[model samples]
Target: MAKYGVHQLRGIIGDFSRVTHFPNANLTVVHNQSKRLNQSQDLSHIAVALLVSTLMQERFVWMTAKTNGTTYRSKIVRSMEEAFAYIDDYRKTFDTVEEP
Candidate 1:
């Protein structure tokens, strides 16, 4: 079931919140590491492409861009202060949560 549920493209698309007011919420950070991320190195560079796609979702993502091997950084951040200051015009939504 987990495999059936966690499709990347659909997951990213479905998490958008359209009706809620902007939040002054804190963002969560995501950091990733792998072993084969060097240019023309013995290891493959697959995750690098994935990280690039993920980062393009927003800005100021606070990434520690790698100097070698397959490592990636990310965060699920929310700052109404910064959002309103910068990202207000570019509206976005997040994945849905059921009301309690």
Candidate 2:
């Protein structure tokens, strides 16, 4: 599920960049990171695509994964702080050069 969330976030960033006529290399970096994550996890493309479609219409996303009888959950909420935090972390995660 983390893989799918990153995938959706990348797509949204890319589409926004194109629609606004503002090209951003950081967006591409993030997309590449997500692609790598997906490949590393060996996720199902079809399942991820369907999940991305479902997430497009929703303000909140919740994902869960279970291993060794333990379950983990991650939630993304549509709030100003959450959005900013995600962007900040993404920027740091990929170590992209910031634009002035």
Candidate 3:
């Protein structure tokens, strides 16, 4: 679990030249105070579950994508509780799957 500001997050992503350099699973929370992220930055390859807890009308849009046989999951929510629940459900559903 790691917390980063919008600018810092952008820098981190920009620093990584390859998608494989990212962690297998990541949980990110975007608070109301943070600025809107750059829409061009694609996080599907980074394997992130994003929680947007903001009242702003303009929100970040992300889609699930598979890379290297791994399916990355992402979701946007209005509250922190919903964010945790989403993560918990994802863990229960995917983490328990037996790879064969």
Q: Indicate which candidate wins on TM-score.
A: 3
Clash pairs (backbone) in predicted model 3: none
Judged by whole-model lDDT over C-alpha atoms, candidate 1 comes out at 0.27
What lDDT score belongs to each candidate, Candidate 1 first?
0.27, 0.34, 0.35
For model 3, the local distance difference test gives 0.35
Which of 2 and 3 is ahead in lDDT? Answer: 3
Question: Which structure among the candidates has the greatest lDDT?
Answer: 3
Superposed model 1: Cα runs more than 4 Å off: 5-11, 15-17, 26-100
Candidate 3, residues 14-62, lDDT tens digits: the string is: 1111223222233122321121232434332232344433323112233
Q: Which stretches of candidate 2 lie over 4 Å from their true place?
A: 2-22, 45-100
Comparison by TM-score, 2 against 3, better one:
3
Taking the tens digit of each residue's C-alpha lDDT, what string does model 1 give over 1-100?
A: 1454322322121121232322323221122222222332332211122212233433323232232322332223344343343222222222222223
Kindly report which residue stretches of model 3 are placed more than 4 angstroms away from their true locations once superposed. Answer: 1-47, 53-59, 63-72
Task: Kindly list the per-residue Cα lDDT of model 2 for residues 1-100, writing each as its tens digit.
Answer: 4655534442121112112222347445645675566567533211211121234323112211121111121224344455455555554544443344
Model 2 scores a C-alpha lDDT of 0.34
